[model samples]
Target: MTMPQMPDSPGTARPFSAELWTAIDPVYAAILDHPFITGLVDGTLPHDAFRHFVVQDSHYLRDYARALAVCAARAPGEDDVRAFAGDAAGAIAAEQEMHAEFMDRLGGSAAQAAAQPVGPTTRAYTSYLLATVYGGSFLDGLAAVLPCYWIYARVGEALLAKSSPDPLYRRWIETYGDEAFQGVVRRVVALADRTGAAATPEQRAAAVEHFVTTSRYEWMFWDAAWRRETWPV
Candidate 1:
């Protein structure tokens, strides 16, 4: 379904257009449609595969924490913006802690896995996101990161629907499909719209670059996951 047009206001940015949504929707959909990721949600992915992802995700979250710190530093005086940064940071922390425990449970070491050079897809996506957050305007950074939120919500919802009687799947789905996680996506999208509304041509161009870059990277991430041996480390 198409996203509804957000109400326009002087402070509101251009609503996510059909064209832009069309561009991003496929990227988001690709992630949701990935068999490995889908299996993860359903607890059908082999334990080894799930454990590998847990390690990779732990690495990803470290970069995410740094990006959140940069965003917090760049945020303007708006309390909501600051709170959003804080929320991002908190999410990163929780992900890190949870993944660390999961790693231990699987007989892995967070430090070793983190120190290993990231896969090409992981490096590309996280580096681009961090660079955007530090080098671009706050709104532009939000645009770059917003896809992750959008994709997560979509994936989470799908997982929730496919959840089985398995306690593990139920726990995973519950954590991601909760209202709080959905709230994060809503707030970020709203922030993006607000930013887009006020953006200068240059700002809009930057945001678009981030949008495209992120979309492409999302596909690469899935591709790498599907073919781990061929994926660059």
Candidate 2:
């Protein structure tokens, strides 16, 4: 389903993220229709596809933590650095605990998860994040990382409201939809706004470009998992 149009008034709206999500609402709306997401939420997703997702996501989160660390390193202020650093630590911990638990239930062992080759789209998505973090400005890195948090929160709430009957899927939805996660999204959105406000027009434009690119990758990543994508070789 297409995302509903945003209302025209900032006076009664949540600040910061409204504009950023608005710019890319269509991309996110398409995400709602992706088979991987729909099937997962509705409990009809093939277990193998979900397994592939868990493995690939396990790999992605590690590189994601590294990318976030890179962002922390490039932070313009101590506060930004601290916030990103904390988030990086959170990402790292999830692999060890949360991902491990889910993978265990799915018959995935740590060694196996580690041994599996990263899928093509997983590699591309993480590479883009790292590239943006390493080569682009601080604001650019922020924009790139925002979708990981923002999209999860948005999708989580949507799926959670449907009251998924699948325990695994419900757990996943609550993980993102919970109050704590939303708080983090809010803080990151505020940070993005602050970064954009201080950046040059060129820098802001570059950041938006990165945001849009990453948003598309978010869709591609799910579609890749749905297909259980692998290298042709």
Candidate 3:
């Protein structure tokens, strides 16, 4: 299928800096602290909670795939951009297929799950990503979505460390703790660094905004989930 196209943009660029990393650190930490996310690692999360998580994640990935497709379409014809797009396509496919199966095994049905609307935090974060992919430079799009990689890696490592005895959590950890998944995160980080290396000041600012906005939304998602608030219609 033909991928969706991003809106046209002027071909401008930017440079990466330590400040960007520093700006995103708190966001990284907050995602790590998300109760539902951390619960996956600690094996303390209820199965129903995971069921809810998986359902929401499945919904999120659908949008994520579209966002990546937009990124791929916007990518420059250069080798590095092409490589990033190719890797992103593979990553999105694996996430969509494997995670869906994992959820199925956990008693989630694709039909029922697909019908679930994205939670508020998920909707906001993904909308921002779609906007970046369509409207921002390629590097900014990379920055906008890179936090998922970093957060997943962190969560996977913690889960692996704690994986044992608990069959349920073991299954969860094994899915993300494997070399293949880690490789995906590593590849994205490298892409982010490379893309960031050439980012302009405006691009950097945009990246920071994307990072902070998504990160804050991530924190609130967990908070809302924990409180069992009825997400807005």
Best by TM-score: 2
- Model 3 lDDT-worst window of ten: 1-10
Model 3 lDDT tens row, 1-233 = 11112333478332243445567677767767777666766567777766666666676776777777777776665655575566567656755676677677878666677787677777777788788878877777777776666556656676686774557667767766777777766666666657666766677678877766665665665665555435656
Q: Which ten residues in a row have the lowest lDDT in candidate 2?
A: 1-10
lDDT of each: 0.68, 0.84, 0.66
Give per-residue CA lDDT, model 1, range 136-186, as digits (tens): 888777777766666666566667767755565466666777778887767
**Candidate 1 wrongly placed segments (more than 4 Å):** 1-14, 17-20, 164-166, 229-233
In angstroms, give how far residue 183 of model 3 lies from its true place: 2.4
**lDDT for each residue of candidate 2 in 1-233, tens digit (9 for 90 to 100):** 22333566756633335667877889989999988889867899887888888889989999999999999998888998899999999998887887788888888786788799998999999999999899888888889998998898889878877757778877888888787888888788878877787777688778888898999999998898889899999
Q: Of the candidates numbered 2 and 3, which has the greater TM-score value?
A: 2
Per-model TM-score on C-alpha atoms: 0.81, 0.92, 0.78
lDDT of 1 at 41: 58
Q: Candidate 3: global Cα-lDDT?
A: 0.66
Q: 1 or 2: which has the higher lDDT?
A: 2
Positional deviation of 213 in candidate 3, in angstroms?
Answer: 2.0
